[model samples]
Target: MSPAAAPRVSVRLPGHRQMALGLARQRLAIGILVFIAFTGLLGFRLIELSLFDGPVQRARPAVANPNIRAEIVDRNGVTLASSFEAYALAARPRDIMGNKEALIAALIRILPERPPEAIRSAIYHDGKFRYITRRILPEQAEAIRRLGEPGLTLEREAERLYPHVGLAAHLVGYTGIDGRGEGGIERAFEQRLTDPAQLEKPLALALDVRVQQALESELKAQMDLQQASGAAGVVMDVHSGEVLALASLPAFDSNRPGGLVGMPSHMNRATLGVYELGSTFKAFTIAMAMDTGVLPRMDERFPTTPIAVGRQRISDSHPKGYPLTVPETLIYSSNVATAKMAERMGRQRQEAFLRQLGMMDRAPGELLETGRPLTPAPNNWGLASVLTIGFGHGIAVTPLHLATAYSALVNGGIYRPATFLKVPEGAERPGRRVFQESTSHALNGMLRLAVLDGTGRQADADGYRVGGKTGTAEKVLEHGRGYDKRRNITTFAGAFPMDNPRYVVIAMVDDPTVGSRMAGSVAGPVFKKVVNRIAPVLGVAPDTSGASEPDIRMFEGLYKPRDPKRDPNAMRRAAAGLPPLEGGVR
Candidate 1:
């Protein structure tokens, strides 16, 4: 209230006004700072989105991964393929700072899949970018990200996933680190698989998962039981040429090719390894002869006595002195009769016939792998070659070739290429004629007779009307000359529901030891098991006679034996016209 105080107050601004001005200054300073920050951020964003567009990335541009779309399904619309999200850790080796040893130690400690040495080599590679590892675990990738290393980058990628694991390993095959097909259906149709449009659509295979599993299950069990070296099997629709089931032992895991022992495991023996597939080839020979009009009736007689050519002798595994009929020859697998039958067929007719059966060449199917047929040329194929090859000697062929051939000979004489993909009706390629329908029918009867009365009884499945031949081929020696009799390839190539002949199943074991048992004892049981399971799936009615049933014929004899001169000169002349006799029958 004093005069001096009033004068001072008049000179000063109001407290409230002063306070308001101070508040404004504070807000203006904050606003300016905020504007500068926002401008800088907007400029940075503009440079990133515009200048670095496709190349610069927050998460590494997905690394050009196929960005796998959904998988393909079968005709039944079952999921055969799908994709899973994965992470790939990579680094610019030049930029990786900290001691190389330390980083590798850290990586090795965390990711043990790759050896420390391997990781070091990869990390130090001379490149702009190199993958440290792919399909990284989320937690692990997150841990790496938290390390905040500028040199290392974690990329988001989509990888092809086979949900069933090994369920369809051979059927679907698998992809490599890069999205490329490696084998089986995957490799066979790599181009189609990589096609984006095809990826959207489902890939249907002819395989029945159930049948495949069953076949594998039985085969694996038998293999272990017999302690066999390797096993292979196939179930094909005779009518459609669709492979319902095909499997090979020492089968590698598609998820990881290196998971197997070696390249040997990758080889598809069913389609690749050529062998002198013993008696099973007799079916084709007889069929060829019959079709050529050179084969006599099943009742026609052949020389049961041993036939000699040079120093080599053609003798039956189960020989008889009396002349054997055509059916008897097949039933007993008489080497003499079959060889004689080949002589009757002669070279021109035999070679022509075999070529007709797709025997003188290779057959490439839908597999990335292919099979090579080992047939002596007509010039090299002398009398001996004809006889030897006629009985499945002198030359070798893959089990698939024989299977396809047998399928043709029995399935109304139409040899359809076996397929893994589900083929639409009428889409199958028609094969060259190998035999007459009549020959096929007769073959069916003989095969039935074989199961009932011959070496192939083990192939019979009650109601399935199974017909086939059993072959025990000795393995070729490593050194060259003779066959290693101790190591044998036991095979049974047969068809079931013989009357209808819907599917053909082939079972083969490589170097199967004659343990305490023989081929018939070891491989035969496996054959029985496979047929029992697959028959019903094929809609083949059970033979009223269980699998143990045999066809016993009480029939009249076909020919009267000629009581002629036992001429040694005639036999010596026969011996002159035989194979090279160099390679032993395996």
Candidate 2:
């Protein structure tokens, strides 16, 4: 082993060769280290880019059509409102390549409705973007696109379409250009309508389009005939408080929201206008009296003579010239008798009854246009107030309030809050009991009798057994300083098929002319027309059979027919309290 070690160091080499070999070894070692370092740096840079680099540049989103909003339908699946795709004309001020004046003139030619000044302003504005016109027709959009203006653009948008024009305008409402609800049911259900999860489903309302048409037709005809300032009507299901038809005259087209500016055409008179609904209150008064046992029997007599209270005299519009039974008071619409009955009930009980019937508060429903009922202050609710309110003078309420109260009166004494939505089967809330079932039955009989033989004769629909009350209240003028002798608000509060009432129909005319001022002459006829047409549509079969035996037996001998042959002088003498006939008043 020692000998072999000594032999290895004997060789000599040139300086350049040795230096080259040394350099090569050193370079090889350095190259291997550099490779490892470069590999690690590249791996670190890749990880950094993957985890911590700013957001990577992404391609612009593709332009797509706007999504359509949901549709609105009536109870029978009739489409009321819907949406469709449309193009909006917009401009990019920076990208506009055409002459500004030329673009403005071209836009005016295609969309002539736009003012020339507005189009010019939009085209020359400093802003980056502006919409020249929204909801343009497809043809108009195509024409503008073909103009080849770099600045002009057609962006897809959703537009609301009202199929029925003015039908249910107040109920279905209208949406703005930005695809948001502006009023009525559309506004009430805005969240649900625009919800992404429910856009495909249509909203169903409780209104029956057929019934609505009938009601509007009759109300419009009567309004035209009477030359009224305005008219309103409603048809409601009593048990569920579902509003079948609600109409306000002077209706505006929902599709044309711009035309409604500075106009009262969109006022929902049925639920938003409060008026003194005259003798209709008599029915409520009599019902309250019966329910509370103040008037024990239908034959109980109340003197019809004018009652002087606090310098104000309450008298019947048509005097009976003698004491009238509880039933006869309503039949004759005697304000004096109704006042007497209401006075006996007193203000506390009277207010309680009204409050129970939802007359003292805003109408409960989905609509935001409900009016708060006007009532006297607690301190002002004196004896005179009670007497006046008995005939619907001191207290003012919307036609909707009257309709709901009438529903409670005949719908087995239940007072349910009115609803505009379709109530599923067995989904109705249990209503509060405002009167005894027996009281409702008795009132039904009296209402029928009034239509058959009393002042409500004009409201009688042949074979349909329509029953209701007529109201004619003088409008308060000069802000309640006094009443206007020339103006009156006439109303008819009615229910059909008197045996078992299913619907409550209310028709009212504001400030009808003198010739048609009476409710019996104006609103009564409207009610009859509406009921006659909607009865079969609502599935209410006509019962040609006369009043039931119990009804006849109870009402027999209660109403004394006017003797057409009686001496006119004798009748006059009796009215003056100077009696000549044996049956005359003392």
Candidate 3:
């Protein structure tokens, strides 16, 4: 049959139908390509968001409030405390999807410090969210994120960082995980530190890091050598009341403050601990007497014979058998002589002098931890109180208070408030005159003599001409009910370059057991070391004019030789002109 017309069966064909079918096939192919492209783009976008997005994008709604604190720097612009962005691990207990026991066990492996029971309890708690750990490292955050638990989350937060670790820890305190300042200057200046408008500017402290290091090193060495429980030291600009360096040993690292909570190591001994600073107060007593004209002249003599007040007897630790001149009283650190002077000054005048020296109140400073001085009540200011306080036994004051007083003694009698903030050059601080310039000069000369020929002889730092008084006081026990004879607080408070005083340095050792346990043996060496190291850094030139010689000779023949073979009673016998007793004096 013919191909095109077999049995006359021909298919009908229309041009419009053929065109419509071709158009429909094309439209369907184009629709499928568009859908594939849209799906590919969506997948890429999701990958980018998961891998490249910042914590801000990935953080869950349970994040804590962000706290940004201002930076804290030393006088030289070295950063001490600063803030950085960190990731914290948080958990939404209700949202946990993994096996509870297994998840907690795994968490314990990562955070071994957390007990297994703690993890379990936290996960089982009814709270919506809670922090597992804060300030997690990036690797830790990554490990936590890969745990595949819906409850676990990484939250962006700000964390305070102390780059210097334990350096000046007592002064530049740490903050809580929530970024609130907890102590030290951190807490003292919290408002200014957190102010939004002031955040950009760093808080500059008067602390010279070099000086601080020197002070800490010496104090820590003495603490270790003497097996002391604690120690404190300070270096202050006498003229301006700027605290160049303040150190308290057994200090905790500001970075890990939680470890030190409730620990004795956390105490700011320089400011918070009030102590019965022994003979160091003798300088102040003499200065006060001289200033008030109770002692007419340095040549005026006070009986060195033991004085009886009730059952207590006031005697010099290392007494000169003869009477002591006003300057000789300080040079020999004669408690009996000083008590007689206080008796002459009387209670009212003595209290008024102490008040003038700022010893009757808490130390004026930015630190909220400034200790309230333990002064006697008005009614308790009897003759016995006066005698004991004259020799620094009844009254207690912080090392900071002593430092302020010493500054006034050397800085031409100006009593300025101690400050942690740097004082700009030419800045004028409001201060009150506590001593006459003549009185200050005379006291300085006598202090220089004490270091030159007396108990503070060990504290002389070559040409620095270190001048200070040694104090060894028995610690009070049972909340001031009695005294612990074995335990003592040894301190040496002084200033450098006797010719012209620039810095007031203090070193205190709490309960030293090694060697003699005298201020000269424990704290005086620390003062010398600190001054030796920081004097050069402070640009203080050594003056060897030997101007303290005359002052030193004024106390000639006043100090009796200590009999080492009979050390326990040497001081007493020397005072009494009796033969040495067993155990001699220290």
Candidate 4:
């Protein structure tokens, strides 16, 4: 056929057929445009997911970032626990483009702590993704990125950090592998700390770092000096019930809590370990006697003879053989006299007062590690229980329990629950009245007299008007055989600037093997040292002029100052350059 000249093949159609053919061509064009548009969209999405977002991020929705935690700070705004941005080494084995052996060696060099087998498995993982190591340092992340392997990647993550490692470990607590709080205030406030709406807000505790440091340092020093197995200390605001400092010996580092697993260091002795705090309870007994109107006068006398109730005989550690006045009974720490007072109040009145003081229940606070007090079962509480528990035996309560009770006894008799959260300045938490204001006033003088002429003399910091009670209770034998005489827990619970009590401080030492092993010599000195350091920090000014001394006129003629020469241990203590013990182990 000739090219264009001979070939003129054309066909004509009717109007309806022509219309149909044109419509078909238009529909075909539109379908091609739509397919092209859909193909472009799919390609763009693949690039966005693989290149921009990265595979690591694609899997992040399944895992929560541990660093999404709020900081924890002391009352003074000092950082205690915080979260910091860190990097994690991850891998996508299917996308590996480098020598697997070389990559494994490089990773092993970067993170020696990670097992070589783990690294190799992660690189050759038969899965979409795997995590090689988390919480990697920036330098290490940079090193890994320098390897330039397509499969290897660094993912953004977060890590918890405690700057002052063991400062308040038992109180601040540590996080677990899943970034959740496990103990102390951490577990107590886990919800608030991890809430997405409150992530940026810090958890401010009532602890003052200065006070905490001083308390922990002094307690540790005394624990070591006394050759004691353990120690615990607490400093709380008398009026506000805010715990300024709480220390438990053998503290573990919050940053690495696993190092001391199975050891007693992790136990918060101040809050979680309960003990029968001996003669310190005498203060409560005396107050109870006065509050219940059982004793009309502080000068009323109680015979110091041993009293027998059931099979148990109650005697004084330092018995003043002659008849002694009420003031004399406490000054002497006479168990017989204290038991006699308890006999007058009876068990019902005693239990009621203790319940009012929060002694019959678990110590109330923010911490989850709080100890449940071990008291005699209500059905089994008998005369023996009454007599012994009167002077802090039979019933076991935490040091925090005693601290909170002591605060009530001295702080105008208001029983406020102890708190770790910072109470705003000029604000006071409402409290229940446990003792009459007049009774509290009387206790202030009695406690002062105790420090001046009784078993707590070693605790008196000059000019600080420190007034507290000494407790030296024999520990109960394991399995409840009997109290061990050779082993005792020494404690001193008191408040400073007694004329107008501001803070209550308690120090306890477990099983001291050094010196006298008495509360006066062991725990008393601890209280004294802690007071000397914290009084000024807590805004309690020193007044050595006796101007701030409580009015102790009612107790003036009740007892006489011990003639140092008459003290049996005076000669030995002076020879050893130690303070004279007024009533050893009472």
State TM-scores per candidate: 0.78, 0.82, 0.81, 0.82
lDDT of 3 by residue, 1-586 (tens): 6786657656767687889999999999999999999999999998875654423333423323336888999989999999998888767787899898888888887777666777777788687666777787777777777898998888888899999899899899889766778899998988888887788899999999999999998899889988999999889999999998999889988988996767887889999899999999998888878777888866677888887888887777887788877777887899999998888888998998889888888877898878898977887789999888988999999899999899999988999978999998899888999899878877887887787667888898876767899999999995868899999999999997766788999999999988788898888999999999999999987644433322333333344333242121233345456664443112
lDDT of 2 by residue, 290-322 (tens): 877788887778898888998898888889799
Clashes per candidate (backbone, < 3 Å): 12, 0, 8, 0
CA error at residue 207 for candidate 3, angstroms? 1.0
Q: Rank the candidates by lDDT, best first.
A: 4, 2, 3, 1
| Residue lDDT tens for model 4, 1-586 | 6676786778765697889989999999999999999999999999876764444333322324544788999999999999988887888888898789988998999898899999999998887678887788888889888888998878786678999999989899998755778888888988788877788889899999999999999888988887889999999999999999899988988988875666989889999999989999999998998999999987778888888887888888887688888877777798988888998999999999999999988987999998998988989898898889889999899999999999999999999999999999999799999899999988887787788888988888988888899999999999896899999999999997888899999999999998898999999988999999988887888865555567665554567767534232343345456675445321
Output the better candidate (2/4) by lDDT. 4
Question: Which ten-residue region of model 3 has the weakest summed lDDT?
Answer: 563-572
Candidate closer to the true structure by TM-score (higher is better), 1 or 4: 4
The lDDT values for all models are 0.71, 0.83, 0.82, 0.86
Winner on lDDT (1 vs 2): 2
Clashing residue pairs for model 4: none
RMSD of each: 12.4, 10.8, 11.1, 7.1
- Please give, for residues 34-119, the per-residue lDDT of candidate 1 as tens digits: 99999999999987656543223343223224446436555456666677788988877777777777777777877778778778
